[model samples]
Target chain A: MKELEDRIRQDGIVREGNVLKVDSFLNHKCDVALYDQMGAEWARLFEGKKVDKILTIESSGIGIACVAATHFHNAPVVFARKTESKNLDGEQYRTQIKSYTKGRTYEVIVAKRFLERGEHVIILDDFLAMGCALNGLLEICEEAGVVVEGIGIAIEKGFQPGGKSLRERGYQVESLAIVSGMNAETGEIDFA
Target chain B: MKELEDRIRQDGIVREGNVLKVDSFLNHKCDVALYDQMGAEWARLFEGKKVDKILTIESSGIGIACVAATHFHNAPVVFARKTESKNLDGEQYRTQIKSYTKGRTYEVIVAKRFLERGEHVIILDDFLAMGCALNGLLEICEEAGVVVEGIGIAIEKGFQPGGKSLRERGYQVESLAIVSGMNAETGEIDFA
Candidate 1:
């Protein structure tokens, strides 16, 4: 986590909308070494949990989730696909989510065969902002009667309500680096 | 490669329109252990190549690229973002690609900073069928002035023109499993 925080400070670009673009290491351009470290740390945190599978979303979450699965004894990773339109198939569990980054709503879908009843799933993602995407994943798990073992996030906007709301709900959520606050002018990042 | 071919035969669905859906292992629902093996194989194939980075597209390719990077000494992985419309930006290299699967053409964008001139880049992708996505990535490498060492494809549809055309052009293309033919009626897969 320290390494991640330091890397964010050194490479993260701050935009006007409280957006900390760690594209240098986190999102667009990925550091597999950093991802491996984070994955190992998540495995340590969820060591005792009976995690049957890892769930994440498409695009950004795939890399982190895939690497993190290695730490969990190579659990299968199931990414919920996002589509602008609804899927007519009744075979998939669907949930609508608002995109905090792109400022639109989309449906996140998972095939019914992927998640089943009584499975312990760990949800992983790159960024946790207002928690819309995570909520959508959780909704799919809930619909399938799967219990969420924990949530592992690479970076969390701590000033946002997502992390806080999950903790308040008694969910064990671990974020590699949590940005408590950001100064756009000074380019200084505060961590929690 | 034998394991991959076996997975394709067992779990891969032969859908209408010749779409071999390996959503169970390759794309949607990912098998992490299988991906680890894939990474090792890619590492073995690209042995001694000075690959500074692994380039791939968003969504499906990200997972494989990240895992594959581990075998390449933790080389960084950069994924191109797909957009419905092109954005005029001097700091990015963009390419237009037609997706036969998605039924539309989209623009894939990679920031100028991530891809450097003369960097040895290896393009990795899930499927090589028509080669639209792979060609788009290769174009980005060209615009960025990066040297493409080669392409590593998980599955190449040999019946299609993608692999044959790239091979004809003298590109060092390697496919883990090349499907020579597929029969939806008999549910049989022939690999070359």
Candidate 2:
């Protein structure tokens, strides 16, 4: 976690509206080495949880989730698709969540074949702010009758309520770096 | 490659309208172990190329690209995003390509900072049919003034012209599994 926080402090920048940009290593361009450490840390945190699969949303989450899959006994990484394609025609488990990053709302879907009944899963994401993506993934798991074992996140905005809300729901949530606050003008980041 | 072909033969389904669905293990639901092997194979193939980075488009490609990054000396993995986000406000290298699977065209953008001039990159993807995604990646690389070492594809529809076109253009394109044809009625697949 210290490594992540250090990397964020070194390369992450703050913008208006409390937006912290870590795309230099975290999102847009990924640092595989850092992701490996985060995956190992998550695996350590949920060692005995019997996580049958790793669930995440498409686009950004896929990178961390796939690398984390290797650490989770090569658990199959299943990412929920945000856009519908001709290939995704079948019975599906659906959940709607607002996109805090894009400032829009959209439904996240996963084909029912990927998630089976009674399977165990862990939700992984790049960032957990408002928890829209995480909640949507949890709802899909519930609809498919899958058991939610835990959640892992690379970064959590501590000033936001997403991580706190999940913890209150009795969900085992672990985040590597928690951002307490940020100064846009000074370009300083505070980690919790 | 034998392992990949065997897995494809076992789980891949031949759907209607020339669609071969390997969603069971390739795209939607991923087998990380197979991906690790692929990453290793790609590293071996592109060995000595000194690939500074690995590039791919978002969603499905992110999974394979991230895994492949581990084998590439932990080289940074940069995925071209399909949509614009608040974090991605900067000079960008853009390219337009049609999505064969989705029946659409969209601009793929990579932040100018992630890809610098003279960087060597290899493009990775889940599937190569019409080569739309690969071509888009090549265009982006050119825009950023980066050199594309080659292209690695998990599955290539040999019946299509994507692979041939790239090869004819003098690109080193390697595919783990090449499907020559399929029988929708019999649900049979032939590998090239």
Candidate 3:
């Protein structure tokens, strides 16, 4: 976790409107070593829990979740698709999520066959700000009748209420790096 | 590669409109063990190539490329963005690509800082049908002056022109499973 926090401090860019750009090592351009470490940390945190599958959302979370799935005994990763595609035709559990970064709301879906009833799953994603994305995944998991084991996040905006709300809802959320505060003008970030 | 072919035969769903759905273990739901094997296979095929980075597209390719990067000495994986987002700011290399699956044209962008001039990279993707996606990535690589060491594909429709055209272009394309023909009615698949 220290390594991730340090890397975020080193490469994470604070932008206006509380936007933290970590595309350098987190999202667009990925550091697989860091992703492996984050996966290890999550494995340690969720040691005793049963992780039948690792669920995530497309575009960003796919890489991190897939890499981290290696640490979880190579658990199968099921990423919820953020867009409707010709390839995605089947019975699916769907939910709508508002993207703070993309400035639009989109439907996220996972095929019904992917998430079976009574299966245990851990949801992982890159960032947790408003928790809109995670909430949508949770809704799908509930609909599929899968047990929510825990939530693993690479980074979380602690200044926002997303992390707190999920914790209060009794979900064990493990975030490698939590940004408590950030300043775009001075380019300073505080970790929680 | 045999394992991949066997898994495909077992789980791949052949639908109308030349769609081969292997989402059971390839794209939508990923088998990390299979992915690790793929990475090792690509490592074997593209061995001795100076791979500085692994480039891919978003959604499906991200997971495969990140898992494959571990075999490339944990090379950083950079995935091109298919949509504009607030998180994607600053200078970028952009290209227009037509999606046969989504039935739309979208702009793919990669940050200018991710692909440096003279850097050697291997482009990896989930599938190669018409090669529209790979061509867009190749265009970005050309504009960035990056050397494409090779292209690794998980599945290639050999009947399609993508693989033939790319091979004709003198690019080494290693497809784990190349489908020469498939029947939607009988669910028969032939591998080349």
Candidate 4:
């Protein structure tokens, strides 16, 4: 966690809209070494939990989820699809999520074939902001009758309410780095 | 490669319209152990190449690329963004790729900060079909002045022209499993 925080402070950029851009090593351009360490940390944090599978949103979450899945004994990682594809089966557990980053509402879906009843699902993602995406994934899990094990995130915008809301719901949410605030003009960031 | 081939024969669904869905292990629901074997096989195939980075498209490709990066000495994995996000910087190298699966044209962008000029890059993806995605990625590498050491793919639809085109262009392409044909009715799969 210290290493991730340091990496964020060193490489993260504060953009105009309170966006903490970590494209250098977190999202767009990934550092697998750091991800390995983060996965190990998540393993330690979620140790002894009944985690049968890892669920995450597409694009940014895939890399982190795959890396983290290794630490969870190479558990299968199921990523919700953002776009409709003919390849996907017609019967699916779907939910709509509003993306603050892209400023659009997109449908996230998981094929019913992947998730089943009584499975412990660890919801993972790169960032947790308003909790819309996380909520959508949790909804899919609920519809599939999958038991929510815990939530793992690489970074959390603590200024936002997602993490707090999940905590209120009695979910164990673990974020490696939590950015409480960011200043675009001064390029300063505050962490929780 | 044999392990992957076996997985394909067992779990891969041969759908209508030449679609072979391996979401069970390769893409949507990723098997980290199988991916590790895939990464190792790619490492073995592209041995002796000077690969400084692993470049991949987002969503499905990110998981494989991240896992594959481990076998390449923890090389940084850079996934091209399929959509514009607040986190992406203003400066980037972008390419338009026609998706055969999705039936549309979309832009893939890599931050200019990641792929450096003259750096060796290996592009990894979950599937290789019409070669449009690989061609688009090659264009990004061309624009960034990066040397594409090779391309690594989990499955190559041999019936499609993508793999043949890449090999025709004199680029070394390693596909873990190449499918010669698929019978959707009988669920029979033939691999070359």
Q: Write the per-residue lDDT of candidate 3 for residues A1-192, one digit (tens) a residue.
A: 899989988998999999999999999999999999999999999999999999999979999999999999999999999765444556988889998877888898898999999999999999999999999999999889999999999999998889999999999999998999999999999998
Q: Which pairs clash (backbone N, Cα, C closer than 3 Å) in model 3?
A: none
Query: Evaluated with lDDT, which candidate comes out highest?
Result: 3
- The total of clashing pairs for model 2 equals 0
lDDT of 3 by residue, B66-89 (tens): 999999999999999986544455
Native interface contacts kept by each candidate, as a fraction: 0.92, 0.93, 1.00, 0.99
For model 2, what share of native contacts is present?
A: 0.93
Docking class of 3: high
lDDT of 4 by residue, B1-192 (tens): 899999999999998999998988988889999999999999999999999999999888999999989999999999988864444456888878998787798888887889899999999999999999899999989989999999999999999999998999999999999999999999999989
What's the C-alpha lDDT at position A100 in model 4? 89
> Candidate 4: misplaced stretches above 4 Å?
A84-90, B84-90
The CA lDDT at B183 in model 1 is 83
lDDT of 1 by residue, A67-135 (tens): 988999899999998776556879988988998778788888898998879999999999998999888
Evaluate all candidate structures by whole-model CA lDDT and list the values in order: 0.91, 0.89, 0.94, 0.91
Candidate 1 lDDT by residue in tens digits, B1-192: 999999999988886677898998999999989999998998888888899999999889999999989999899999999876546867888888998988988888998999989999899999999999988998888888998888999999999999999988888898999999888887888999
Q: Which ten residues in a row have the lowest lDDT in candidate 3 chain A?
A: A82-91
User: Counting only residues 3 or more apart in sequence or on different chains, how many pairs clash (N, Cα, C under 3 Å) in candidate 1?
Assistant: 0
Candidates 1 and 3 compared: the better one by lDDT is 3
Residue-wise C-alpha lDDT for candidate 2, range B1-192, written one tens digit per residue? 888999988999888888988898988999999999998888888878979999988878888999999998899999998864434455887777897767788887888999999989999998999988888888888878999998999999999999999999999998999999999899888899
- Model 4: per-residue Cα lDDT over A1-192, one tens digit each: 899999988999999876888989988889999999999999999999988999999988999999888999999999999875444556788888998877889888888989989999899988988999999999898889999989999999999999999999999999999999989998888899
